[model samples]
Target: MPKKVPIRKCVGCQERKEKRELIRIVRSPEGEFSVDPTGKKPGRGAYICPKLECLEKAIKNKGLERSFKTAVDDELKELLRQKVTSYEK
Candidate 1:
């Protein structure tokens, strides 16, 4: 039997995709947010596709803020942008 693949929805595109195909953004208990490439980090997580358009959409629609349930400052948003852009390289 083939292994069942985990599925997650992208906050940006609202599309269902395999977990491995999305980047995970995790918010620690201490309220620190970071990208989790391994998808094993503790705390709340939000998934987004590895594309700039998705990232922009997520930002514009406040998807991350809704997922994290906290205000995301501009600095953090810029940091996330950097991380997402790095993944494109």
Candidate 2:
């Protein structure tokens, strides 16, 4: 029998996918928002695809804000845009 892979829900599409296939956005213990490539950061976390489209969907739908239970400022959205765009390339 093969071992089952873990799945996580994407905050963007709200769909379940393999955990390794998604990017993690974390809110640190200090209440800071940032992307965690390592996926080991402390505090609240949200998952999304590395694709720019997914990030756009999440941003437009306020998925991150709901996940973090806080407002997502424009600065964070800009940072996320740059990061996801770079990742897609």
Candidate 3:
């Protein structure tokens, strides 16, 4: 039998989903926050769906802040917006 894959929670919808189906946002040791396409970064992390709408929902509901336990700056929001746009393209 095939092993069941692990699922992760999306801060946006507060739902659990397959890890491979979501994008990972990571905080580096130096306190930098960025999207980790490779999902191999070493630091605190949060998962979200790759869809732009999911990102909007996450930001509007303060889900990212709740997951990271830190306020996300406007600059980071802009960066995330751009990243999600690129992902959608």
Candidate 4:
């Protein structure tokens, strides 16, 4: 029998994809937000594609904010941008 791969939806593209193919954005219990490369972080998580366009679309559409149930400030948005850019490299 083959193992089934986990799937998650990209907040930006609104497309279902393999979990490993997506980047995780986590909101800690303390209300801190960061990109989780391992996808094992404990907190509220939102998945997104690794592309910059997806990141931009997520930001523009307030997808992260909606997922985290908090207002995503500019600082956090910038940090997410940096993380996504670094991941793209």
Structural similarity to truth (TM-score) of each candidate: 0.94, 0.89, 0.89, 0.93
Q: Where's the lowest-lDDT run of ten residues in candidate 3?
A: 80-89
In TM-score terms, candidate 3 sits at 0.89
Candidate 1 Cα lDDT to native: 0.92
RMSD of 3: 1.3
Tell me how candidate 4 scores on lDDT.
0.92
Evaluated against the true structure, the overall lDDT of model 2 is: 0.89
- What would the per-residue lDDT of candidate 4 be over residues 1-89, giving only the tens digit for each residue? 99999999999999999999999999999998888989999999999998899989998999998999999989988887887898799
What is candidate 3's lDDT per residue for 25-66, written digit by digit as tens? 998888899989888999899998877888899999999998
- Model 2 spans > 4 angstroms off: none
The residue ranges of model 1 lying beyond 4 angstroms of the native Cα positions read none
Please give the lDDT score at residue 28 for candidate 4: 98
TM-score, candidate number 4: 0.93
In Å, residue 81's CA in model 1 sits off its true spot by: 1.2
The better candidate by lDDT, 1 or 3, is 1
RMSDs, each prediction? 0.9, 1.3, 1.3, 1.0
lDDT of 2 by residue, 8-87 (tens): 99988888999888988888889899988888889999999878888889988999999999998899889888988888
CA lDDT of each candidate? 0.92, 0.89, 0.89, 0.92
